[model samples]
Target: MVIYIILFGYLGLSLLLSRLNIRSKIEDSAQYYLTNRSLKGITLFFTLVATNFSAFFFIGFAGESYRVGYIYYTMMAFGTSFAAISFYLIGSPAWRLSKDKGYITPAEMLGDQMNSTALTRLTALLMIIFMVPFVAIQIIGAGLIVSGLTQGAIPYIWGSALLMVFILVYIWRSGMYSVARLDVTNGILLMTLIILAFVFVSRSLGGISEINEQLMEQSAALFSPQGSNSTYSPSLWLSYMVLWLTCLPMFPQIFLRFLMAKKESNFRYTSFLYTIVPPLLFIFPVALGVMGHLSFPDLQGKAADQIIPRLLTMHLPGGFGAVILTGALAAFVSTTDSTLLALSSLIARDLYKPIFKPQLDEKGTLTVGRISILILCLISLVIAFFQPASIFQIAAMTFSGLSIFFPVFLAVLRFNYRKPISAILAMILGEVVLILFATIFSGACDTLNILPVVPGVLATILILWLGHFFEKNKD
Candidate 1:
């Protein structure tokens, strides 16, 4: 009941803000989608952090840490560093191009820059395809948290639906501007929750020093990979790093953030902040996992994702528990809104506007974007109803699947790999190879720590090179 109250309180606040901030019907359509391009440095910074962190960071990251050990931190390091690199390399250029061309979506930027209608359509199609899985993962996370706290009374579908309703109400009102402001508030709540959880939980477990001692005593591998209890081998480490380095940055939500900035300088400053903040955020979850090991080592399966919730419910006092749980719910809600908005924009601007109706005005685009948001949210709610796998597992699978496209996009921007044929070949070869390798030698390869996409990446490269060579010769 306390948890429910805390969550709805936040939802109520978000809805209220959305109602106040929404673009008036009399206002132009540009004000609705882009929030009049008036985001300042701080709001942009929080939006960047909130979107990038997501429910994946809270639930998925902690879950991964529990199952995989400290090697998960390496994944965070790879993602943050490489994403920053991509931001600087790809983001700066995309910002400049979008501003100059008045492009709103990534598909528009790619389509206009390359002058290929087919390429634009393909990018939008691929984005929609990938975004379903991505949005589904977040819905699963939100559902898991709500269902776990409510103890099976709330059903996953209802859990997802409730959150989505609030999200829809808020987004329908204010669009991106309302989402950004709420995210800033969510960020503050997240930090407060983390600091409090760490301090209180560590005290309960006997102090930081004692907790460290307990972890080492329980699983020396948690401290040192060279130790006998360590699960990660060299092969697994390499695969993990490669998968994250090549793949993590291309998240469409992250790319949409590059579009949200009021100025190019915001992108540059935010990238620098990313490198610093992600590592600090990793500390809270890493510490929680270590303590969880010492306290509840035998918990397994889906129980892993529930460790923190179980900890709070079983141990903490009333009001404090509600506050911290509210923070967790906030994390989930903020990430979901950002993702829904991104997916909606892709469908609205890219899929609907230029291809289907060349004459889509601002009002038409806004209607289409809102409608897209509703359709996508419904799809995710349906997927969340099944609730087969852990949210983290689904997220990891989706991340690997999307890894196929990062190289192609990076090549197009940084290198001269602009041939549409090369781009298509890379995506196809990479996906096929990934599917084949994961299928045939599935258990052995997975045990050996080989990423599903490694084999496909090699094929993608070869095909891309051959296509580029042929195109150059034809010229």
Candidate 2:
């Protein structure tokens, strides 16, 4: 009962805070869709942290670590570090141009830089499609967090619905401002909870070295990047790294933060800080999972996914469990809010405005954005109720499409390609081919071995070349 109260009370307070922020800045603009270009250094730093630390970091990363062992941490941390480095390399250049031209979306950025509307819309549409699954996953994750903390008293549907309501209320009010503000607050709480949980769990499990010894004994390949079980092999691990590097940096949610930065310098600053913060923030969840391996060696039933929650419920005493639950909820909500906001902005500004209602003023755009957010949240809630896939699977599927998008844009960025039609055709072909590949060879991914992203990127290049060839002949 007390846990339920804490959950509901936290939701109410977060909603109230969101509304206050929204009303306070009711005059905020379409320009503010990526943030108003007025953010200070600290605010931008938190936004980057908040954007990257999605529900996946908690549930997926730790779960992967728990199942695979410490070596997986190196892979995750390596992927994350590579992403940060890419931001510095490619993203800094993009940010400078965005400042010069006042760009709001990556679609706009790509379109403007490459001079291709078709390419812009294609990227925007792909972003929206991929992000739907991503946002839905986060919503589902929030529901899971609520359900777990409440001991299954609350069904996943109602828990998800409650989160959806809180998110809609908050986002409908402040737009990106509310998101940025809340992200900072949520990041701090997340850090605190991580430290607290580590302390509590470590004490419960004896200590880090003892935990390490048990981890090695229970799974011989605990420190082996070769993978503990046969499920992940050397080639497969390399493919996983390739897939993550290709897809994650281009994630619309992450890119949206780069777009929101105050300036090019801000992008660099925030990106640097985001690099350090995530690995540290990530270690706690990893610790929880590793500790789980040590303490409850024979535990089953979603053990990896439930590491933090199980630890809290069994190891941490008193009110701290509720507090940790709130932090996990904050993690879910932060990811969901940013994702839903980015998706809605894409729909309203990039999809609807350019196509149907090009005459909308800032106020009109704001109205459309808020309405789109409401509609998107409602649709996602319906999907969550069905529970079609696990949260991790949903995230993986979302990125599978986006992995194709990244390479196409990289090609454009490298070549300075002016043909929008070619770019669009390439993106579509890449996505379709990748989907076909995944569907056809789904069984072979394990035995024969091929990372999904490689084929999509190759297909993108082939299509672009074909499109260019045809266009030249037509000319």
lDDT of each: 0.72, 0.73
lDDT per residue as tens, model 2, 100-208: 8877677777876776666677788888877887787788888888887887898888889988887777677667878887887787777787788888888777888
Local accuracy of candidate 1 as per-residue lDDT tens digits, 309-365 = 666665688657667877777788788887788778778888788778989887778
**Candidate 2 worst ten-residue window by lDDT:** 21-30
Q: List the residue pairs that clash in candidate 2.
A: none
For candidate 2, report its TM-score.
0.91
lDDT top scorer: 2
True-vs-predicted CA distance for residue 66, candidate 1, Å: 2.4
> What are the per-model numbers of colliding residue pairs?
0, 0
